[model samples]
Target: MASRSKLNQICQFCRCTPRTELKKCHKCGSVSYCSHACQREDLTNHQRACRVAREGVIIPPLDFLKTRKEKERLTEILTHCVPRLLTALYNDLARWMEAKSSALLERCINDLKLRYTPSACETHVLRVVVSRDEMWPSSTSTPGELFTVTKFQVMDVQYARESMVLWKDCMRELEIQRREAKANGLGMIAVVGIECPALATVRLLQFTGVGRYLLVTPAESGQRSHRRARR
Candidate 1:
């Protein structure tokens, strides 16, 4: 066996003391820290680097994609293709049994139906439907018909096990749908919208294989309260 000294050291950020116990960063095994507090403090500086490390390559967001055509293209891609890719990646990470496919899909569908509206202190949920033309040929009879619908829900906390489970289920469905679409020559895309803490968003991104994620804040008017606190 290799000597302990020869092994890669823990990140200074996660490690309490580099001279002794070495705890690596859970997100990116790169930078070392001594404690959660240190890791949180270093996050402001590590955000950009951590993103690059996780993605393997930096993709600068497109400024021009604001146009109608770009929007449509994006919608198609997300609704039709992204989900499957995420599912495949998630499967590779956790060798979950394929037998749970039906149950997983049903659970996702039910979750979509729950339809929790966003209110003060509550996360918002939205569903984006991809049109038929965007779906792979096998699933498309009419090009402009509904192809697939993606559901998104936001939460305030950081890395809740329940939230992670939901994300995993969504990813699995996306993967299955994408594969089915491809086999039948149909396009697959997915879109998600959520209102949650930035840290929670980052955790979600790292856990899920979705490459495109947008963090939106509630409007200022919604944030302000003309009336005094009730309590």
Candidate 2:
């Protein structure tokens, strides 16, 4: 049993059990890494949890939104797209953070402001919708009419301070649904990437354990949560 458990065990960052000893984080004691390199590699994802745990802050797990079947469907759709989605987010951030020209900075800020509109939850999320062209037209299709239900996966883009209200409002709405979030064809899954643009810093938020639940659609409200993607 001991050997079997070890075989199944993996590092929190690299997800591989190296030949070297695995070390549990001294502060949080919840994460284990196979090496210093692995720990450093995971710092972007683990920083918030480590600090919260060390400071004794208790964060409630965001409520689950979908039934097992629906969740499985959401997972199936997202499984293939997460990498590209994350890369897009990183690229978007890099373009902003590394901008040296006023024109470029202004353009990035305006674009991001539109993307992160506080009133539109969908705007805050980086989305991947199934291509309508790839979708076969139904009998009722008009020349330019769009489909009512779109298949998509969205990841939240978070900033600091004032955005906390937006995060809470999103949570309250989802919580009222009692965990039965709606599902369209593919349903939604939560992925979050945090940035403090003022500070020019970004952390790749990786949801682990129950921390995965946050903003979702109404048939979808519930799952991966929104928080201060702080500096």
Evaluate all candidate structures by whole-model CA lDDT and list the values in order: 0.40, 0.43
Candidate 2, run of 10 with poorest lDDT: 222-231
Cα-based lDDT at residue 182, candidate 1 = 54
RMSD of each: 22.5, 22.4
| TM per candidate | 0.22, 0.23
Compute the lDDT for candidate 2: 0.43
Against the true structure, whose lDDT is highest?
2
Position 226, candidate 1: lDDT: 16
- Candidate 1 ranges with C-alpha deviation above 4 Å: 1-17, 59-231
* Tens digits of per-residue lDDT for model 2, 1-231: 559668646899878877777888887887889888888899877876886788865433223645778756655555556556545444444443233222222222233343244223322443222123323324454422322213322434343223544344443443333234323322332223233332233332211221112222323221211221121
Clashes of each: 29, 11
